[model samples]
Target: MKRLIPLLLLAAVPALAAPVAAPHVAARSFEQLAKPLPLPYAEGADADAAVAAAKARARQAHKLLLIDLGGNWCLDCRLLAGTIELPDLNGWVKRHYEVVTVDVGRFDKNGQIPAHYGITGRLAGVPAVLVVDPRTDRLVNKGHETALSDARSLTPQALADWLARWV
Candidate 1:
């Protein structure tokens, strides 16, 4: 038993020492940020259609559209949204991309889109961005790939740059 303990401890060392990189941040030029991303999406209240577009785009070009899913009263959603609507970012977003704000009942008293979209977690705390490709409706990214789902770190400009890279 004592001999085995030494081997087991050695094996665990690698797992504990893995490098931890800080969350990714994009630093693109302001001028580039202002330009339209050149990807277009069809719009309606139909989330299925939206997901379908995601699938199609994913298959064809490996692109994902940013989906801000939240109710009106979620504070983080509020912060993320308020940041996006700031004049500089807002103007850029208005010209360069398609934004769909889904009311998933976090802030709203009785919204149904959250269930329709198969969401199973916090509705308001979610700055839940579904980067879905339109060609095949595949999901490319959801805010973060961390150990805990509580790791979404996106600024409107940083998010805009991330989306641009895929498109």
Candidate 2:
């Protein structure tokens, strides 16, 4: 009976463990996403000021800073923007992050933004998402900066999952 009780307790341990919840994602496929995807990067806006403001907001809100370094001309960047703006995902993002989009025109402009995170030289690709810890002003997801650079090839849910991983 003692041995049986121990086995029963071990079996119950699995059930007692809390399940990790998957991130909320509304779009299952690319076609389900909104048409004429949003151009999130503002070419004329001051990228430095925007990042500063976002960092401030993130610090105050106790949220992470999500710096989206990309260009309006990039299709993948647009795709990532549109997926993030999905009604459900947008709300989730707002709850967890302060987002700032900086236009890196042909990877020529906004070089300093990525450099600020210790990512020198040319970037891997557009939509280099710098997940920052606003409290410390440090990049959280360092090596994975360009993980979503090929957003076009991934499903919206996959993108949402990637964003959620930082949180």
Model 1 residue runs over 4 Å out of place are 1-64, 107-124, 143-167
lDDT of 2 by residue, 1-167 (tens): 98899888877864354433436686788778788888898888999999999999999998999999999898889998888888878888888889999999988998999999999999999889999999889998989999988888899888988887778
lDDT of 1 by residue, 1-167 (tens): 99999888877864344433222333333232333321222223565555446445444543335566654444445545554554555555543334565555534322343443454444435546655444434444533411111223545455445434433
TM per candidate: 0.44, 0.86
Model 1 / residue 76 / CA error / Å: 1.3
Candidate lDDT (C-alpha), each: 0.45, 0.87
lDDT (Cα, 0-100) at 85 in candidate 2: 82
RMSD of each: 10.7, 6.5
